[model samples]
Target: MKKAIKILFVEDEEALGMVVSDSLRSRGFEIDYHTDGESALQATLTNKYDILVLDVMLPKMDGFSLAREYRKVNRNTPIIFLTARSQTEDVVEGFELGGNDYLKKPFSMEELIVRVKSLIGRLLYSEESQLEECFVGNYKFNIQKQTLELNGKIKTLTYREAQVLLMLFEKRNQVLERKLVLDQLWGDDSFFNARSMDVFITRLRKYLRDDSNIQIVNIRGIGYKLLI
Candidate 1:
């Protein structure tokens, strides 16, 4: 028998929660539904779920804080936010707080289901055996350890820096669109996010300056190319 997918779903609205949880359970998902963020946080620490579905608003604690705390310990499991706040900043904040997908309120069960399956599919696919480390212009980069080493010196990277660097390294010698990076990391391509990415790019350049052969070229008005 195929193993059932497990989900930790947190929603405060009783009626909506019932409908959604029941719908998911009917589709072969094992659901652990909660009405408050505090209990959800506890559940996260003790139980491992394939994915987490969190509502933006909840009693005792808000979803963003819950996700933030949850990320401190476990960064592998995917999280989706169910929110009524559709503002771009709100969406961006959720992603920054470690959310994988954001579904605004009034969403159809079909759309939610699709997103859940899509995230799980990607997660499973990524778990396949692959090279954990690679050489980037004489520097050894470890994707899982989030470390870059050169000549016996190691510089650990922040999560965002590692994520950006990984994306660039994956598409080395190719043009990586700025919008795609922003969308993947910041969940949007707004002015603020663009400036933020610029800062990161500058920092990355500083980190790789020792490797004279490596250059992250800015393709004016377009995107960036990692010319190694």
Candidate 2:
């Protein structure tokens, strides 16, 4: 049997959390649930999780702050934000902070399950053994090792960051849709996951900052383009 996808879920609503947790468990997901941002962040640091489902509004830390702190240490774990706030700015802010997908409150359990499956599928497909080393501008990326080397100096990449970069490299000069990216990485295309993808993109840009010839371009409503 395939390994279960590990998830860390941080939600303050106790009733909602139980329901979602139970639903996901029934579907064979390995889940860890928490009620506050601080404890969630701490648990994330110590545990190995494939994905994170976070709520924007939480006691003690809030989802955005928790994500920001998590990024400082773990730059690649995919995060999906679930919140009742539907404001455009709030949605934008969540992406800016590193959320991979977002789902508004009162969402259906079926939709959440579909999104999770999609994200996990993308991650699994992205790392298939058939894929070989790829070049991104001046640097060469060894996907298996999650390393990028330029001029003989090597830089290690977090697993999720490498996954995103590899996908962009595979579709270089083409529009990589936002939904496709989130679906592949976080298993859903919710608002929180969209924001999380943005954060990963920013980190990729920074990693390749020295190479002026390579660029990761945002195509507005579409997705991203890796210009080499």
Candidate 3:
């Protein structure tokens, strides 16, 4: 049987929260709703959810601050920021802080539903063990374990990080289009998601820097080329 999607929804607005929760529940989602950031944080620390729907304005803590704290422990589950503010800076900050998507307030129920489904479909749960292992210069990358072994050390990677590395390895020596990476990994190719992809690429480059011959070359206007 297919499992119902679980959601952690935090909103301070009582009426709106009820409506949203009910709508999601009606659509077969398992919704755990909270009115304060503190309670929501506790809920997340104790329970697991497929996705997070967080309102920016809350009583105890705001969405951005809560997301920052939450990311310190959990980086896999996707988060969508819900805010009334439409400022580009605020949206950028949300993405920079690890939010997977952002939704402006007064959005349609259909739009919210579509965004949530998109994020759930984009979950980086697994892209591992497809080729057992790959050699990258002096490092041994174990796709299944999501680890990179260098000398005598093994460094673990987050699911998203591992997925990004796996994609690069699969497309080695070729330009992996930015749109493809952003769409496959983030569910969209928005400017915010593009920035996030750049961050991931930088991180991967740092991880593989021990090998001088390894390079993730930028294709100027296109994407990245992983050369070894």
Candidate 4:
């Protein structure tokens, strides 16, 4: 049997956290809930979680700072930012700090569950069984191990980054529409999400920079094409 999906959720509001935790537990997900960013960060560093759900405002540290620190040590774990602020700047900042998704306040438990489940489904189950290894120009990508090898150097990729790269590789030399990718990964193409996509595209470009022949070219107003 498959193991339960693990989640580390951080929220300052006691009532809300309890409700969300109870709801997720009812759905059979393993949860480690915290009320402050400092403790959350410590927990993340010591434990392995499939996904992170963090609130923006916390007692010791803010979500953005915690995410930045978390990425330094662990990039593979996916992160979702919870915030009452829906401003474009806040959303963009969250993504820039390596957030996978931004969820605004007053959200429905059902919506949050869907987002969490969707991320788990895509990040944990996508393409692991069928694709063992593939090539992107001169780089060897191992899907199961989630590593990129080139020139005797191996680098790890975050789950989202690997997913984006895989999608581009599958459509090599073909244009992948922006909205299609956004929907596939983020479940929506909102302005904030679109901006987040740009960040990931930039990251992919940097990752493939070693091979000049491999390029992810943007098709203005259309999408991106991976030219290999």
Predicted candidate 1 versus true structure: per-residue lDDT over 1-228, tens digit per residue = 998999999999999999999999999999999999999999987898999999999999999999989988877688898888756677657755667777778999888898888778866765663967899999999877768999999987655677788889888999999999887665568775677678778888988999999999998977888878
What tens-digit string does per-residue lDDT give for candidate 4 at 1-228?
Answer: 878889999999999999999999998889999999999999987899999999999999999999999988876677998999977778767766767786889899888888888877776666445888899999999876668999999988766677788889889999998898899887798887888788789988998899999889999999999999
Write model 3 residue lDDT over 7-122, tens digit each, in one string.
99999999999999999999999999999999999998889999999999998989999998998888767899999986667776786676877888899889988888887775
Candidate 4 residue 127 C-alpha distance from true site, Å: 6.9
| Full candidate order by TM-score, most accurate first | 4, 3, 1, 2
Global lDDT of each candidate:
0.84, 0.82, 0.85, 0.86
TM-score of each model, in listed order:
0.78, 0.67, 0.79, 0.82
RMSD of every candidate to native, in Å, equals 3.8, 4.5, 3.2, 2.9
Strongest candidate by TM-score: 4
Off by over 4 Å in 4: 1-4, 45-48, 72-74, 87-89, 96-98, 144-149, 152-156
Ten-residue region with minimum lDDT total, candidate 1:
122-131
How far residue 109's Cα lies from its native spot in candidate 1, in Å, is: 1.3
Query: What lDDT would candidate 1 get against the real structure?
Result: 0.84
